[model samples]
Target: MSFQNTASFPGAGIPEQVSFDRKELSVILSLYGRMVAAGEWRDYGISSLRECAVFSVFRRTAEHPLYRIEKRPKLRNRQGQYSVVGIDGQILKRGHDLKTVLRVLERKLIRAVD
Candidate 1:
């Protein structure tokens, strides 16, 4: 079996950090912009970790993240790769499609718009 570029450290078993590609980032940022314009979201941060890629949204910089969008490639076959987790660590949505999972957050945006 070949590890290739994905699993760089063959012996360490640390596996490289997961990350969002340009296209994925574009989609995430598009929603972020709309939410920001609606004043639903104030700040955001991205974290690429060994297990998953996280995009955390904060209403205020000092407070905890209000929501987190995570991508775990390992779950792509089982529970799906995309998930929306709330501030309380509850899974709001989980699916194979990233956009579909992110729809959960759009509900807040809808409320903010009207």
Candidate 2:
């Protein structure tokens, strides 16, 4: 029996995973910290997928995420690369600028503090 060598295939070794960069994470975490301090958010999860990266924010560990921040590089030119999704699967905001997209949640944070 002969087995085919998978290593000979092009792009076989490289994983096409997408994830938040240092600067992006820095911006997200800054908001997360503020929300946590205000008692609006608690648990969080990060997922790096082949197509997009997601940062999910949760009020509790077991419950669904209150929001999802997604980065889709493919959408960079079409609808911007960054997006904020609400719990109901609605696109809260979308833009090329990460900070601009996150401002939706920041508004919530302001309301949360009030």
Candidate 3:
């Protein structure tokens, strides 16, 4: 079988995978640290897809993710790129500002303390 170098051909036009930049990861990790300290979070996973990137938080490694923070650049103009989704598969928040969108999860930390 023959192989193709689509990845090597710059002009071939493939969608670039999305990922968390350093600044974005810093913000996410900051919240993760606080949540972990609060005993609300235990594990996390990250996915870099062609059209979107996701950061999933888990209460336990063996169970399903408790939350998923997604960045879909394609929706940046329509519904904003950053979003926080609950374990029930509901959108907790969506906004252009990553920090603002993450506040939804941060609020949980407060309730966990109360």
User: CA RMSD for every model?
Assistant: 5.0, 5.2, 5.4
lDDT of 3 by residue, 13-49 (tens): 6666889899999999999999999999999999999
Q: Between candidates 2 and 3, name the one with more favorable lDDT.
A: 2
Among these predicted structures, which one has the highest lDDT?
2
Comparing candidate 1 with candidate 3, which one achieves the higher TM-score?
3
Which pairs clash (backbone N, Cα, C closer than 3 Å) in model 3?
A: none
Write down the TM-score of every candidate.
Answer: 0.84, 0.85, 0.85
The local distance difference test score of model 3 is: 0.92
Candidate numbers sorted by TM-score from highest down:
2, 3, 1
Q: What is the lDDT, from 0 to 100, of the residue 31 in candidate 1?
A: 94
Candidate 1 segments exceeding 4 Å error:
1-15, 112-114
Question: In model 1, what is the error at residue 31, expressed in angstroms?
Answer: 0.5
For candidate 2, what is the lDDT? 0.94
The sequence of per-residue lDDT tens digits that candidate 1 reaches over residues 35-105 is 99988889999999989999999999999999999999999899999999999999999999989888888
Output the worst ten-in-a-row residue range by lDDT, candidate 2: 105-114
Candidate 1 Cα lDDT to native = 0.90
